[model samples]
Target: MATSRGEFSSSFGFIMAAAGSAIGLGNIWGFPTQTAQNGGAAFVLVYLVLAFVIGYPLLMAEFIIGRHSRSNPVGAYRAISGGKPFVPVGYFGIIVAGLILSFYSILAGWMVAYAVEPFFKLIGADDMAAWTVNQGNLSRNILFTSIFYLLTIGIIIGGVKSGIEKWSSRLMPTLIFMMILLTIYVLTLSGASDGLKVYLLPDFNKITDAQLILSALGQSFFSLSLGVGTMLVYGSYIANKENLVKLGVFVTLADIAIAFLAGLLIIPAMYVAANTGTEIFDEGGNLISGPTLVFQILPELFNSMGAIGVPAALVFFILMSIAALTSSISMLEVPVSYAVDTRNLQRKASTWVIGGFFWAISIILVIYFDKLFGLVVSFTTQYSQPLLGLVICIFIGWVMNRNSVLEELKKGNPEVANSLFMKVWPFFVRIVSPLLIVIVFLQSLNVF
Candidate 1:
């Protein structure tokens, strides 16, 4: 192994890669859906505050550990584990990352398939288009999931600067561009202004609701892809000369901006769909969420537009596919780095081997989708991630040596020495951030 694995080619490249990992299906679909489900702008307002209060601090904790060790997430944790039991927290994180990718690829596969569906339709191959959208078709699910895995693996095989950074630098801007164009298009339609009203105008009464606040906190956490070693791995790749404080703020802001921008598109489009007489809200008056919103409701909104609808759906799914791929590449990197670091494997071989393992798991989940899918998602994301995040705060806050942590940050920017972040973070990550994560964890227990 090279003494140095590799570094991101530039600061912009690093920012895009890190931000891309943060801005996934969650930002595109999950954020907006949560906004609609709660009291729209109220959720947005709370989520924004928590992004800085909760998300950025945890994010910095990962970056500090990551660059300090200059190793994989497991390796980084092991370097600081101080004991055996804590080591498993490192192992558990990659497991969560793997399980997350397994199901994540399945969702992204649908986006990939949906992106392709319009092509078939445009060519008059309506049957082929229908086949692509048919989730019950085992062949369809397997094929697209495989395609997504291959795409991720191909990028990984190219090494850090050439692969992950290069693609992220390209895809993130494209994703943003598409979101802007789609938002502008949707806003021009009749009734879209009503959605704009709901999305931008906060209902402070609901903002105080315990459940809504918890939901916003959870969205804030998960939207950044925290608790997974993905950020840690990305941090390990960051340059010593890069000012991580500025970089962290940049990535956090990018994530919030994109997720907020997605709300601009998604909510308004839902109202526009409602104007077309499509049932955008359920019997309880909550906006349709999860797979139903992406696969069914939004498609209805797109299709109601007549001739341009096919291409419109095409662009939207392509946008979703881009967002999904950017995140998947980062998730896949966690295990790939572990394999390379621990198993002494070649990065090329490791990407394929590890990606194939997750792909097989995805295939298995697709086969037993109804039974296993929800179980794995909840098990990995809901339970495992927050617990792992708790470990991160504990390690960075209470466990790791303070001088050592500052030494790492100093490598990137010496001025970080007396910064306000230095003044607040130690205490915040120690007491406040952990307490907030505990609240989020408790909320996940079905208590509101």
Candidate 2:
């Protein structure tokens, strides 16, 4: 009863899923925190450079392996590396994907709660103070967390083509349309010039810290879903005829554009709302946190916009919800696809079972151990994600045969086989990629 190795119905569907994976909570929430902490425009520069160097080529490699192997991450790694010792790296994907989704579901649940904040006046003025004050409370946090789990389960029960794909196809376009509209509205505010200055103005002196550079690079990878098996799993469903290089570049551009645009809308609004010039950095020198930036910062911005605040607030949250759901579908796709491909499970059964497990796990995260949100964050970042990513990068870099990899890359772009770009790419794959990851790992662990 296992689902067959299915092909995407069209190139667009493949792009949507891949783009969906790239455009998740990280792009929306994580990107802004990194930008604000790292001195806005300066961080943007470092982020773009990292994206081109470390991110884009690896993304292309994932697609090549996926299409060439026509298998999930584990099987794909085994097939592509042949009898090489690096095949165990495929298990790294499963471990990272599972751990990521667990904590990620908790954050996604928060998005769902924010979307519904208006219903209880939890968003406006005095009501907001009470909500913010109780942000760490156990009961309220538990309720919202449970809601997140249920929503994820509901979507995952729909299966891939029906559940994940259908929802993303509808949601992604809606997200794009709404964001553009929201951007236009934000730009028209009376104080928008000041806000724009805060967002776009470069402050190089402040951005030189090595931590900021590292944060920017990390955001670039996380935002693109690069380190995880997300892109590889996405590549598995790709049709042979699709122009993969074109698709990879397009998706990367779209993901980066959205993150950049998100900052434009938010930072400008932050300035206009504060009225007095609020220093972008906090007094403690910690960058503003994510939930604080979104729930508190945005509501204040909306209030400053005069009579337009109410409708705009609704639109902004609605847009966020759509973006969030689009990305959530992609995360859910990883596990469900693996269950079907590896365990010989029916699509519906796989979807529900995997989705339900994540949901239940998130409830424990949100409800029982609410105090450990920081720990969850630490686990994903300092340990789980980097470890999983390091293994995969080394495998692609050192283990996969040069001739076979060249052949796969050539299929999508004829010049890739013989060009100078190909010459430099494998060198990075074999050496630079692994070395950089090792450095990042040690840095995260304070080992060096």
Candidate 3:
């Protein structure tokens, strides 16, 4: 294991940084989409359970591995497994990190474009439909994508303490504050209560559907930033004295709160739009999915708000841009840590080289989004994430020596070492978590 690396300035810094990673586009965008598509509160209920059941244990496994090895993903695996055979797991994580960043940066770029829309007078223009049309223009997307990439790379190049932790501590609070403010304003809108009921009230029939359950499971994993080595990489920077369990709980709760608040804002806003004669539902009366809900539907919702819509749209996109940046910084850090640890490169050099490569790739993705975007997202999120998560669970629960794990867990909380969790967690990780992840993987394949 490497002896030298940056440590979080405080436990608060670590939690905030980790929470920032957890609270990203997945929370602000994906969670609301899934909730709208699934059974709303029913999906939220399952998602919460799964977050603790599968997400927390698996998160603990990654954290223990990182803190134990005291290195990057690749080095951590090698260090814990005593090298050879298992080292590729770490490499796999690095590759997954890069894959996620590629597509993630594209979406984040859209947020940047939207954030600038008010300044460009695009939000409430008479030709608002043209604004959406222009968003699809290849050159425009590339410009914004490149701009977002540069922002991400700039933060990552600042290194951990100066870059990630510092910004996370600042931006996370701002994100939350924005969400609360937006939620308050949105709730006061006419017909906003109708959206809130749809979001919070569970339809038992929809909740019982297999597809919705699977979606909730998937969202739980994705929202936690698990299965991509993000948590593992961040875990390496945590102070030895910090309690992993406490930290994990805080991060998980914060992520859930952000998503819930987003639901409050988005669902109510959608209803408010409906009150203003916008079609939030299709002819079949189903809520629209994915980009429709975000790029098209939400824009219409804000537009219906009259003059308030402009500033609302601005704040919403700014909040989204911040969310995207926090997550992107973590993704960039994975490969940067690998280069610094395994390849012995300087942090700034690794960040620039890796960030530049992804920036170019993100531009390609933006240009060919219709053909390649969905394919990349499906492969990475469906196949890669669950598969990697399964491998990590197996390695930590079965391959790595249990005594070593206990020793690591005992670092800050001796009580936890002897507690019931110490006894049950390994068993759950070994048998239960992997099985559920396999179910998620198969569900992704439509193999049910």
Candidate 4:
């Protein structure tokens, strides 16, 4: 059981895998749109602080516990608690992963559909191109959703170094390069300066707003892939010689950088859209957000560019699809790793079985699009994720001995004992992170 479970072949592979997990559809679509909907740079300022202060500590909780136990979230919890009730939390995390991927695959499918539409458009098959991007086409949605799942499953069936790491290394750089070029080009367009000003110049007064703070905190958690055991599973694969503290910082920064760049690319593009007579805001004056902003608003903006629009839209949706794929692979791995490590299942078979199950759920959600889709999304991400994260924090800070965590950190860097991380992190993970998460969770429910 111990020997068969794969380890990341190098620090680079792990960072690429882990960071790729963290940088997903949210960073590109949700984060920038949320920034615009909130107070723009004010929300970015708050999110920047929360990502490190709140997100990092919880992130390391997964890292320390995962490396110490060297197992999936379930095994890690049981190992830490010495066969106590905390084991259920691990199973709960696995359930959360499935539920998230169930709905998430649908969104990724939309990206894939949009990506494919440009090819049809290029071939002068305008009706086919129109059909691909039409949200009303259930067959199109289901088809692309299955395609996304197959793409994710294809990578996972190859195992760690060859599968997750290899694709992530190629995909992350490609995502970044395309992101930078798009940002530069969009910035060159007229009226993008308005969005640029909104993104870069903070409205300091709104930083103190409670809603912005809670939203930033929630985004930080979501963006880092914490509480879902994605990070925990990734952490389990890290080579023992790696400095986890350094690695954690690298992944977090990479996630943050991509999200920040998304703000640069996307928000500016929104203003550019507005300049071309597209409505950038809703009837209520809020910045259009979520799928509407991604699917409709942004696509309209692309279409207005005439002949250049086809290839540009292709590259944009492909970038979105790449971001979605990188993250989806990690989500799928949570269940696959559990089946492999604890259930004595094979990785390839486990991936297909679990991946197929989630795809089935995605199909169900697609069929019941008006009903189950949003419910599943809210349940998985908004509610269950923070609950799982809170539990993990409690496990490490309270259940596991403080010394045990210190010892795990010492594996890659002996200097961790004397470092500031040793002095501050234990306390932060135990108290600060849980409290912050609870606040965010409650705020999400409108209890405040």
Tell me which of candidates 2 and 4 scores higher on TM-score.
4
Please write out the lDDT profile of model 3 over residues 248-295, one tens digit for every residue.
888889888888888888888888888988888877777766677788
Candidate 2 residue pairs that clash: 397-429
- How far in Å is the alpha carbon of 44 misplaced in model 2? 1.5
TM-score for candidate 2: 0.88
Per-model CA lDDT versus the true structure: 0.89, 0.70, 0.85, 0.89
lDDT of 4 by residue, 1-448 (tens): 3345878888888888898999988888789877876788899888988898889998898988888888988888777755368888889899999889899899999999999999998889999988998898899989999999999999999998889999998998999999998888889888899999888887878888888888888999989999989999988888789899999889889989899999999889999999999998888988888888898888988888888878889899999999999999999999998998888888889999999998999999999999999898889888998899998888888888878888889999999999998888888888999999999889879899
lDDT-wise, the better of 2 and 4 is 4
lDDT of 2: 0.70
| Candidate 3 wrong stretches, greater than 4 Å | 1-3, 122-133
User: Model 4 off-target regions past 4 Å?
Assistant: 1-3
Clashes of each: 0, 1, 0, 0
Colliding residue pairs in candidate 4: none
Q: Where does candidate 1 stray beyond 4 Å?
A: 1-3, 81-85
In TM-score terms, candidate 3 sits at 0.95
Candidate 2 lDDT, 1-448, residue by residue in tens: 2135676666777777778778876677677667766777888888888776667777877777777777677777666645345555666566556667777766665666666655455345657534623556666566666666566666667755666667667777877788888888777766777667656777899777888777776776667776667787778777666777788888888888888888777766666666644444477875465777776777767666656775787678777766766666666667777777767788777777777776666667766565765786687667766666666666666666777777766665767766766777777656765666666777778775
Report the Cα lDDT for residue 113, model 1: 98
Query: In candidate 1, what are the lDDT values of residues 1-448, reduced to their tens digit?
Result: 2235878978899999999999988788788878877887888888989998889999999998888877777788677646245677888899999999999999999999999999999999999999999988999999999999889899989888999999999999999999999899999998899999888887888989988889889988899999988999899888888898999999999999999999999999999999999998888878888888899989899899889789889999999999999999999999999888877899998998898888989999999999999999999888998999898999888888888889888987898879998998888889888899999888888765
